[model samples]
Target chain A: MTIRQLSVFLENKTGYLNEMLAQLAKYNINIIALTVADTSEYGIVRMIVSDPEKALDILREGQFTVRMHDILSLEMDAAPGSLSKILNLFTEADICIEYVYAFSFGSKSIVVFRTNNRDKAIEIINENKLKSIREADLK
Target chain B: MPREKMRALQTERLKELVNRVYNNVSFYRQRMDEAGVKPSDIKTLEDISKLPFTHKQDLRDNYPFGLFAVPMKDIVRVHGSSGTTGKPTTVGYTKNDIDNWSEVVARSFTMAGISSDDIMQVSYGYGLFTGGLGAHYGAEKVGCSVIPISGGNTRRQLQLMADFGSTALACTPSYALHLADAMAEHGYSLSDMKLKAGVFGAEPWTENMRKELERKWGIKAFDIYGLSEIMGPGVSHDCEYHCGLHVHEDHFFPEIVDPETKEPLPDGQEGELVFTTLTKEGIPLLRYNTRDLSTLYREKCECGRTLVRMKKITGRSDDMLIIRGVNLFPSQIEHVLLELGETSAHYMLYVDRKNNLDTLELKVELDESKLTDTIRDLQNLSRKIEHALNSAIGLSVKVTLVEPKTIARSEGKAKRVIDNRNK
Candidate 1:
């Protein structure tokens, strides 16, 4: 399973995010799953995009400081305890999940998460036979 | 017979300098007394070391007329260096002094193979700064048809150079390069110009720059070195060989010495250049420190002049930079920047110390429309500049790419470096 993630370095200013989004719109790059890590000064707008490479190129060419990072995406049943089950397996395997975000597309639930121990998390996924999606898998 | 007569004349001038400095300037008198030496101690040229060394700061401390040996009424002209802060170091010249200054500068023209038949255009700035008037008077003294085109007006400078059949030009090396660029922009060929020789000075320039200017303008580039403190633009000049500048030691006694210790050094050893004005009647100096770092030689020159010669000034003691335990000069940075080709002349160095490490950040202005603000391109240029600076200065510099027209230009002397690293 593949997940698209955008890492944009934002300077502290009003309407900077809006300006960045407008630039993306001009370049015809679409944002799908989106989240923001914010500080008092600026916010890092992270998004799963329809075209990650083109979005990155457009953002960079427009002079927006950006980086691309790999994220783990898991497709689960759109049930109440699906994310909870994944978290319990990570806890039992002694893998610390830094943060997690989830979005639903029809009946399928997609949860993206980061762990301190990526290898341990991958092992737990294999042992528990959990469905894990990579960035290439989405493409 | 000629050598004996020259020695007698030099001795007579040296005795006059000793008496003037001892009687007139109290600083020199005190300094000479402290050294257990009197005016009577100087018998020959070798006795020059017995005198006290004069420094540029001494001129600054005294300000306008404290260093003059003669009365102010006898002083006919006053010129000065363009100092940034406070008052500049003012130099006074009597009528005889002006005549001597003109003679030395005229000799510089003759060394460059410029003759009375040549129409010389003097482009150095005039006024308090001595370059313009100095060169103009010198060209006139040499019987050359002089065009006192005192700097700027690049269009008019070019027009006069062409129209007046200007066979020679005198300006700073940078201005000469600027004129060449302007000529190219106006679709004029330098090859078609009657210009044969160029006497470039008032700033230290490298031999590479000489070659570049010569190749561009098809003229012989002569290095004329001088300062207002030392009577301007004819202290020393390059001959046809262009090996080293020959100092008129008969008029001005040249010495190379340790800047800090004040002890004289052997020939070929790079040290601070010091001069004692022998024949200067108004403001004769007793071993005035020039601060310019260069070596000296008393060997017979191929140009048939027995005067002492000095190497091209590599750098100034005041401008020596210690960056990350490495010493650097602005000329080194200029060489690198000129080699890069795409960067503008505007550059500002931001030096800061953090975590006990000295950091040098060179903010280079990009040429207009040369490179966009794309992250990749900026990073690439930064890397390229960093590598070049590291190789040139022997220290890694954080290259900050700035837009054009950010850095300020100096009207008189260009401030090439901003040094913030202090002990």
Candidate 2:
């Protein structure tokens, strides 16, 4: 299961996002999951696509100013204490997490996170026996 | 003196320069050795063909004191580029070199019909760049009262021009236009000002631009040409006739050569203009390539200066864009933009390679009052701009309508193009 993610550098304008989406439509690349991380000068439009390679090539070819990143995916129970329990495990292991976002794919609750020490976090995840999904598994 | 006597004198100076550089600077000696030419071999001015040509990159590669023929203690002043992107090209001057530069600038001012009683307002920026200080020293040498305005503060510029009764102005042509716009906004009539003439340079401008400035400000606009590498903005100046800019070839030798072939071109044939500073002491250059595209004229001027004259620079070799085997220049776009009355001069050109196709997108700012929020108006403007740019540049451009004041305004050199073709 491959999760295609887009990291776009977007300068602020009235219809900049609309233009980007229109270009994507022209390439027939579908966005599965999308979020915008923004500052004053520009915004990064991150998206998981149905076809990662095709989307990346299309965006790069069009000079739309985009990047691709591999993010770890963890499925949590859709219960009250699920997120807290998973985060507490990382804190116990002294893994520094930078940012995290959550989204739903069908009935499953998936959490994507970035960490300061990726290798160490991976070791911690293996030690605690937490179920970690690779980008391909997310597909 | 006869032309034959002048040629002999130049040859003698050339031999002296070659011998001095060969004996003093190791770089020149090594380049001479690599070229298999010796200083003793240079017997005539035409023997310059045997010597190697120096380039701007040579100065940059050597950096601070690599090319200086004199000791650091003997050097009096140092000027340089802003070094915004890379290491600045540093130029050193002895006291005598400073005197020579001032004298040449004074001659330029005199050629423009500025008198000793004239008051000059120098608006070119000072510091690292030589334009402001060069003009200031030149004006002083010309026995004129000089105001070193030193760029920006348009309101204060207008105030001083009126208060000090500035008779002549020296600055980049674009800033002169900007000042004209400022005066209009303040409801000040340009005719009421005491200004009589303007000396504009440090960038290439067109005849249409000169005519526009002359009509708007009621002043005779003169073109002055120079580079920091060759003693700043006093190398040459236009006379009242405006036929060509006269070069002070006694100190600086001018040549035009085919950029691709490196072969010398005849007079009136357009090519890259090259200069060799014959009199510079600190950092004398032999056959320094200026990269500016222009032609040379040896004809006598009505002003009585017998020095060689250079045609107004049409474009630069490096600035030429080879897109789809068609050469284009930003000035070509400028010609079209000037014709479009509804569009502001401020614009941004985006060039990118998509699907192996070169795409040109022009973002032009439209004056809001002149534009109606209608599709037909936008379409018409776009089509007109497209047609004009295509006709002028011989390349199709996609015109994008942007709001007023959308593009950035630069106080120094404007950033006109954003090239994304490389990725």
Candidate 3:
């Protein structure tokens, strides 16, 4: 129902992201799905990795501002209006989508997002009979 | 006060003050004993040079109540200035001390022609800083309609000025300019209020500032000077003549000394201003070095007062920077960073005047061992440092988290303070 994500704070400077990714690569950590939320000052590098606990320790030891959080990932048919259909359920339920990103594999797409009401969003997925992905599934 | 009479009174008070501190405060007693001087040594006003000068560090070393001349029960009020570290430079006042403080303040208000009929709006901040309550007490003594509206809340300051028709304002010179700008931005005109005169102090301002403030509000702006250690804002004030500020020599004696040599400079020679609290009961100081740079004048002023006059403070001999009326030292900022425990002490302070308001921005180097990838965490870290500094110094500083090792490391004594306010 949820996947572990690593969020790192990076200043909006040249090669800052490359520096962080290089550090993760040093530990042989594999980045599964990644996205960046940024402002003029800095950027938040959010990623789902194969080994989150090891990645967290490595980044923390390197003196990086990093944290881990659980976000929901839904597997949907890789088709037109697939994201819109899933989003409509949340909009009708009055549950806010804080942020959303997607990655595709085979004939299906995995949509990752954090919501204002996590418990309610989970309940909506269950009632609507949606396929929810987990950390093991992403790996 | 006439010249001869003023000198006689100062000599008498100086004798008493020396006797009090020498007998009560061991810090002062030890200092005097080391200088091979005694209470009887201060016979004339000139004998003050024979005594050792107390530096700001002396107050820090004495800490909270070590330098107080009287018992804690006798102290009626306490005020403090920001120090370089955790402890503040504390000053106490007895009942008689408060009365003398009110007298000098009332006299200062009188110098600017602010009287009983005028509605005085005291915009200086209140609480431990001393500016707010100092002006409030003086305005009450003058029998004026005292507003007591402390600093900030610009909209309310303008509202009360218009509705209450305040004729006099007492605040920092920069704050006065800020208020004028706010008034215009809020669609206010001078005709809407009855503000006529302003008494500005607590920060070093220039003659050009006096002219600018006078033109902005169409009011006569008078400079008032004092420090919390020497009884707040009533120690000296410029008379209507505006030649120089007339030191309330009857209470606080003023002197000029070469900053490096510590030798007393002659009258009209620019040097560090020093003071001797002649009548203070709570914490009587013996030739305290103020560290402020200025000249002294003993000539009879055109306004007919014979009190010794001190020229406008040109600058300070130390690295202390006054931002928005709050005395700030770069060492204080460094102390905050070190206290934060996560950030390095390596930092730089950029001080600038934005729209006539003093703005301080602190650039802190992010520790390589504490890099967090989330901007939220970084924002929280910066806010934490900002809150700590604000509580410590009483000034809101904008904290900018810079790249690791981005702040250049110097060979010896890092040039931390980059003040652009003068430019």
Candidate 4:
């Protein structure tokens, strides 16, 4: 139902993002999926990387404000209505999705998101028999 | 008193002060004995150099009551300045010492042209700190309708100024500005109040600040200089002429000594300011090095006071930073950081004046040991440091966490303070 994600604080300066990415690239830690929440003062780079534990150590060693958190990733069919169906479960359950990002691997689509309700969302997903993603599966 | 008569009186008092301290205070006794100088040696004002110079560390070394020239039974009150560590460097005052303090403050008010008809609002903080009670007693002695309303509570300050017609306001120059801003914010202009004179001190402020304060309140701003170690905020004050502050030479004798060599400099030469309490009975310090840098002018002031005038203090010989009237040291900040064991020794202090208020921003390096993966942890660490610093220095410090190597380093000496204040 969930995989580890790395969130990093970045100053809103030019080439700062590149500097963070370069640190990861130097350590051979590949970023799988990423999204950035930005404000005028700073940015939070929320990312799922190839080796999250190793990537956490590397990014922190490079002096980045990095944190690790659990985020839910749902596997779905590669269709136009796939995300709409998965999101409708949360909307019907009155669970608010904080943020969402997606990518496709062959015929299967994956939607990774954070939500306000974690336990209830997990129960709904398990009861509905929705295919859940794990950290091992990502690795 | 004329210059010659004042020096003669000073010489007489100097001999008595040396005898008092050498016979009463063991600390001063040992220092004088070690220097091989006897009380008889201080027969004239020129012989003050024969006595050993008292450093701030001497006060700390004596701690609570070791430096007092009189017994605890004779001491009436105590005041102190916060030290780098938990212990405060304390000073005690006898009943007569308090009277002298009041007299000096009264004289200071008189110098500023404040009279018994005026209403005075004393805004300096009370408690063990000397500013509040110091000015309060002086204003009371001057027969001014005294408002002992200590620092803060700006709306009430302005309200009292309007309702009670406070003619004189006394506080740090910065707080006076803050009060002015607060008055404006509360829709009360200068015309609404009856502030005629402002006695500003406890912190070093520039002439521009004096001009701004005068302009803001439409009052004549006067600079009053004093430290808790030397009797509080009435040692010297500027007259209506707005020249250098006139020292009350009859009680506290002022001298300029080279900061490095510790040799007496000429009257006009800029050097460290030193004072010898000619009349203090409780803690009679003989030639105490104040660490303040200023010049002394023996020339006759146009206002006709023959008392020696000292220029406004330019800087400190030490690294003590006065923020909002609270004395702080960089080593104190480092001690807090070390005690927390959360930050690297490398840190920098950024001091700036924001909206006429002093702001102390501390930038500490986050080391690997204290580094955490959560923003909450970092925030908590910074807050912890802020709380520690606030408790240690009695001043609110803004703590900022920077990368370990972000603060600039130098080979000669790592810079610790960046004071961006206009002064």
After superposing the true interface residues, what Cα RMSD does each candidate give? 9.7, 15.4, 4.0, 4.4
Answer with 3 or 4, whichever has the higher TM-score.
Answer: 4
lDDT of 4 by residue, A1-139 (tens): 8888888766567998999999999999988888887644445688888999899899878877677888888898877797889889889999998778897654557889877798988988988899998766765
User: Poorest 10 consecutive residues of model 4 chain A by lDDT?
Assistant: A36-45
Top model number, lDDT? 3
Best by DockQ: 3
TM-score of chain A of each: 0.89, 0.86, 0.95, 0.95
Q: Give one digit per residue, the lDDT tens place, for model 2 in B180-225.
A: 8789766677765899999988767779889988987899999988
**Candidate scoring better on DockQ of 1 and 4:** 4
Report how far off residue B311 is in candidate 4 (Å): 0.7
List, residue by residue over B1-423, the lDDT tens digit for candidate 3: 668887888889889888888899998888889989999988998899999988888888988888999999999999888444677889999999999999999999999999999999999989998899999999999999999899989999999999999999999999999999899888888899899999999999999999999999999999999998888999999998899999999999998999899999999999999999989999888778889999999989999988889999999988888888877889888888888887888899999999889898998877755654445657788899999999887788999877666688999978999989867
Q: Better model by lDDT, 1 or 3?
A: 3
For each candidate, the DockQ is: 0.03, 0.03, 0.23, 0.19
Native interface contact recovery, model 3: 0.33
Using DockQ, rank the candidates from best to worst.
3, 4, 1, 2
What value does the lDDT take at residue B152 in candidate 1?
Answer: 78
TM-score on alpha carbons, each prediction: 0.60, 0.65, 0.81, 0.88
